[model samples]
Target: MKFRRWCRNCNCEQEVAPIMGYEDSWRKLFWLLEFLRTEETIAEATFDEYMEHLMFFGKLAFDADDEIEKRLKEEEVSDND
Candidate 1:
């Protein structure tokens, strides 16, 4: 199976053939979190701004899933009609 990488910053997509192993991918994700945690500066505000960004991204992801489901349901209804 082939995997694809999407760059949100560059708006580019490329297919990666013979993707890395599952364990490697998991490790990469862990490393990425660690890097973000250590490298990104968190302001000394009342709340953790970093966490706010994470929550925002999480909400966006959930919203996208909800939208996809809604569109699929609408399509199904239209097809039945």
Candidate 2:
């Protein structure tokens, strides 16, 4: 599925972008998408892989913000324990 957030350069929130598909790719794609938002650079190979996944996954955009938030919180709690 895809996700979106505020984009400073565009001065508006972008349309949801499908970054990845499948359970396995979703986790890493979340972080990579965030990095792109902050104007961070990823390796060429990784970028190619993400784009390939995007095409292969077909059109599926989901607001995974809440899921990401929950996972992060769970990780924090486990870390403290």
Candidate 3:
């Protein structure tokens, strides 16, 4: 599924796909969405600004690790069922 985030320039939410050459980071994008949910500045920051933030500091969240762990747990549960 495509990921969604707020865009200050569009003055509404926007969808984004995995960036070229970084398809593995789609999970990170999901993490970014969850990260943005509680953030206050994205509402004031333009889409480019957001991209810049992603480019520079996106990997700090470690959400992908949590997501992977959760999925593995789900697989284990399904296997047991």
Q: Please report the candidate that would top lDDT against the real structure.
A: 3
lDDT of 3 by residue, 58-78 (tens): 555466667888999999999
What is the C-alpha local distance difference test score of each model?
A: 0.54, 0.56, 0.63
Once superposed on the true structure, which residue ranges of model 1 sit more than 4 Å away at CA?
1-47
Ranking of all candidate structures by their lDDT, best first: 3, 2, 1
Evaluated at residue 60, the lDDT of candidate 1 is 67
Clashes of each: 0, 0, 0
TM-score of each: 0.46, 0.25, 0.32
lDDT of 1 by residue, 37-67 (tens): 4333432323466557566656665687799
* lDDT, model 1, position 35: 36
Clashes of 1: 0
Ranking of predictions according to TM-score: 1, 3, 2
lDDT of 1: 0.54
Candidate 2 lDDT score relative to the true structure = 0.56
